[model samples]
Each structure stands twice: as C-alpha cells, then as structure tokens.
Target: MTKHEDQRLRIIDRRTLWNGFINLEQITLEQMMSDGSTARLVREVHDHGRAATILLFDPERQMVVLVRQLRLPVFLQGESGYLIEAPAGLLDGEAPEVAICREAMEETGYHIESALHLFDAYMSPGSITERTSFFLGRIDTSKKVAPGGGLAHEGEDIEVLEIPFEEAIAMIRTGEVCDAKTIMLLQWAMLNRAALSG
Candidate 1:
C-alpha cells in the first residue's frame, strides 16, 4: 500500500447509524505533523456511504436499457425535464449487485440474472461525499415487455427506454446524455463490449 492507502486506514472508531436516510459521525480532521512553515496540509476523510449503477446490456439484442426521469438539480441548471440514466440507487445496507438488480426491476421491470462489477470510483470529490460502484449486466430483452416505473410512494416517476447499443454510443457523441456515471459505464462498455457480450 502507498502512503495514501496508509493514511486512509488511520480512522479511529468511526461510527455510522441509520436515522431514516443515513447519519454518520463527522470525521475529525487533523493536521498532519509535517515540518513546514504554515504551508501544505493533508486532509483525509472517511465516507460512510455507497452507491450502485448498472449498465443494462442485452447481448442478444444489441440494446442497452435506460430510464428517463425528471431531476430537479439538472432542471435547475436550465436543462430539459427528463434525464436519461441507467437504473441506479444508493446501497442502503444492501450489497452493490443486489441494490442494482433491485433497482433494475423497479425502474425497468426487467428481472436481471446476474450483474458483473465494472469498477468503483468517487463521484465529485470536490463537494459531495459519496463513492459509487458500477456494474454491467447482460439482460434478456426478449422477455422485456413495456417499461415499468417504480412505486409512486418512492417519488420515482421513471420511464424505461431501450435503445440500440450503438445509439447509446451516439447519444454520448451528440451530447444528449449528460449523466456522469452513465457516461463512464457506457465508455467502459465501448471498450470491453465484445468480451462482455460474449
């Protein structure tokens, strides 16, 4: 392990509890005892959160499944009403694969067989405190019927959309798709798609 990894494991008794959504103890920030004249400071933070996103790839049909939903934050940035994104959700004590599969069923109504983990990364290190684990799943679109939005009580008004795998690539080129996590997963698919599909 490198110095950064060593620093990351230096947390002392971090506490995390659930009080509705999620509540975590504020990490105590300490100044590194480096010999410098009031200069550089290294800060390490421990995040008590997790997120999961799925790129639904139908190998047989050459299509990718996505969902359109209204995101107020994006709308406030002067965009359209609906944002196209893959089925994703926060890992509320559930495993990443389990959470993503459940989200796929709720958002798109397709029951997934298994999800393959692509990679894990942080989302916006400048501000938000969150890490996302991305997964790629080979879905069977043959059994897929009409789209299915999630339950209303969860405030999810999602609309399922299935597009050609190539078309999803085109959306990234035309700047139609702007979601960061979705873009990353799609790019990864573009690179290792043949192996993933086979």
Candidate 2:
C-alpha cells in the first residue's frame, strides 16, 4: 500500500445538500487515529470547482491593476460589500493560464499575452474544495483595449482601479485591500520587486 493508504481513511457516507451556482454536500468519514483508534466524523463541504487569479503590474509606471465588486458575504458580515481584489474567476474547464487571461481582459481591459505561474493554493482547506492558481503578468496601462466593467448579464458590476505599488501596499495596512488573494499577490510582488522590473 502507498503512504496514504497506510493511514486507513474511509468515507462513511456522502449526500448532496444543494445544487446551484455552487454545490454543497454532507460527508461522514472514518479514520484511524494516532492512538490506533478509529473515529467517525461528519462535515459539510462546499465545491465551486477550481479557479485562477492574476496580478497585473506595470513595471514602468510602478502600478498595479485591480478590481472592486460587491460580495454578499462581506456585506452580510457587517462590512462593505465591495471588495478590492486581483482579477480572478472560475476556470470552468479552461486551463489556468487561459482562464486568468480571460478574466484580466474581461475585468480590467488589460490584454495579457502571457503570465508567470507563481503557485497554486487552497484558500480554505477545511471546508471549501476550491484550489486557485496564482499568476503575475506585466501590463502596459497605456494600451487598454476596451472598457471592461464585467458582464452585465452575469450581474457583475466591477470597478477597475490602478494604484501605485507603494500605495497599494499601504492600503493593505489600512484594510482597504482585504482580499486574501490580492494580499498574497501584493506581498509576493514586494518580495520580488527587483525581478518584476525586468
């Protein structure tokens, strides 16, 4: 058996709880503990499929392109519903590179020929089954090809923002930029600023 098989984990039961734009399911599982005892546990999982996000940077101008949109969850939690985030969207069966590129164009009007694949991460591993691919793409803000505010049919009213790199970092401290993915990419840019100019 493989190393994973040695753990002795089994699924007891699984049932769909909801099916809509996202899928929710209840799952019960059994696993062998470190003390050689078996334990059963039940949990709910949210599956929204895989997704991708990209940070668009203009090295010459030292600015970053971002988007702001309403998020019901944040509003329900008593905070501003609009969130400033890196351009991102569900892959929907497309390749990570292709999905991120399309999202950038549709949300920011920046035509990205290609992007550097930085990493992939599970934003919330405990319950959500979404794994997002992170990328960095250089952009020329002077070459905007379209007026991108997202699709009206999909109810997306996105506001595009261009902030200086230093100011963007300061916004993080002030909580103006609170999206986890955007924060991560901004921190990455800080750590790799030297390479970004090249």
Which ranges of candidate 1 are over 4 A from the true structure? Answer: 1-30, 33-35, 38-48, 145-147
The regions of model 2 sitting more than 4 angstroms off are 1-6
For model 2, how does the per-residue alpha-carbon lDDT over 1-198 read when each residue is reduced to its tens digit? 974475579888999999998899999999889898999999999998999999999999999999999999999999989999999999989999999999999999899999899999999999999999999999999999988899989999999999999999999999999999999999999999886876
Whole-model lDDT values for every prediction: 0.80, 0.94
Give RMSD to native, each candidate: 4.1, 1.4
Report the alpha-carbon TM-score of model 1 versus the true structure: 0.80
Model 2 weakest 10-residue run by lDDT: 2-11
lDDT of candidate 1 over 26-115, digit per residue (tens)? 443333445532323333444547889999988888999999999887889888868998889888899999998888888898988888
Please state the error at residue 36 of candidate 2 in Å.
1.1
